[model samples]
Target: MAGATPLRVLIGKVGLDGHDRGVKLIARALRDAGIEVIYTGLHQTPEQIVASAIQEDVRAIGLSIHSAAHKTLFPRVLELLKAQGAEDIVVFGGGIIPDEDIPILHAQGVRRIFTPGTPMQEIVDFVKGLGQ
Candidate 1:
């Protein structure tokens, strides 16, 4: 396993959501856990996010949504991934998402949703499990 590549992930903030403190924290946590993280900063479109994921060759994409755009944005990313033949990249998110929206998001192919107060270790473990 010495030559094995570490799990790489793309941490993105899509739309006009300017609140990136949480995303930055998660990025740091993932890095601390030894996962490679490509922080895409804020104000990314679904196109930009998917392009980055493909370009970076990441195994997963983590979106930080606070602008109530998950319904629209998450699916667009998924669609783009499929269109680009990158559908195997797992998509997950965390932020101000309501409980009622979780099921809808999952149905749209979002692998998981972590709301406020979810532990950082939980996120780290979830990403780590993706390789298995």
Candidate 2:
């Protein structure tokens, strides 16, 4: 999120995903691209992430879950966002997610999904494009 409104973005790690190099790279890239990023380091429950997102008033949420819990973690995030009345917020994720599960993720309101080898510009542009 950028421009005059400066859509806030919450970059979070859900489940037990400890590998965060990719998360840091995306966060840094967003910051460099002039998007304000709120990085939630590691080991975040979906509830906590959503609560913070509502409190911070972010326009989009980018989750970086590398663990196998994407199946479980993804829906909970959507549920909570719906509960918080922020369902309009754009949600997406990146990590070691399987292609089969991606449609399910999107169906649950995940706007984008980037895998390990996906280009960095894609992530930045996708997130930035939300404002458009």
Candidate 3:
């Protein structure tokens, strides 16, 4: 498997959420771990996010939202991916999401949800597992 494509991930911030410090840290960590990261800066819409992911041909998407809009935004991204025939792209998210909403997000097709304070290594391991 020499010279295989390095796993690519798109890290995005959706909605009016101006909180970006955490997403930047996650993007840096992923890059440090040797994963190629395409970061679509703050204030992106779900359509923009999915379009960017497809254009980048990423293996996964990491969305961060602190706008209390997870219930709307996360599913919108998943739905858009499916509609674009890119459902194979793994979708995951993190933010101020509540524990009670984790299962809801999963049921809506978000593969994983990382709440605040989850270890950085945990996120890295999860993304690395996607490559295998």
Candidate 4:
């Protein structure tokens, strides 16, 4: 993990969802944790997000999805990463998601899902623990 830069994170708001409160919070939390965080604002396409992640060379990609596009968006992001040979980058998601959808996401190669009320500390710990 040399030159890790304290675990960089790309926090993005994907799809047509204009709501970005959650992602903003995550970005601030990551920044406060001394990790480099890039906030991609709102209404980002999957391609834009992946491209940003690759450019930033972030260790993880955090998708803040409050819309009903996780099932579609999540897998698409994975596909984009695979296509670009960036499949090793850790994928994380936050915001509202059904309980039944968690396993499917993990099976689809998403490593972490942070639901509502997930503390900033937990998110920080989760990302840090991933490097272990």
Candidate 1 per-residue lDDT, tens place, 1-132, comes to 243988899999999989998999999999999999999998999999999999999999999999998899999999999999999999999999999999999998999999999999999999999876
How does each model score on TM-score? 0.97, 0.94, 0.97, 0.95
Question: By TM-score, is 3 or 4 better?
Answer: 3
Q: Give the alpha carbon lDDT tens digit for every residue of 1-132 in model 4.
A: 765456778899999988788888888988998888889988899999999999998888999888888999999999999999999899999878998999999999999898999999999888777666
The Cα local distance difference test for each model comes to 0.95, 0.88, 0.94, 0.89
Backbone collision count in every prediction? 0, 0, 0, 0
Can you list the residue pairs that collide in candidate 4?
none
Give the poorly placed runs of model 4, Cα more than 4 Å off: none
Worst 10 residues of 3 by lDDT: 1-10
Q: Find the candidate with the highest lDDT and give its number.
A: 1
lDDT for model 2: 0.88
- Runs of candidate 2 with Cα error greater than 4 angstroms are 1-3
Error of 1 at 52 (Å): 0.4
TM-score for model 1? 0.97
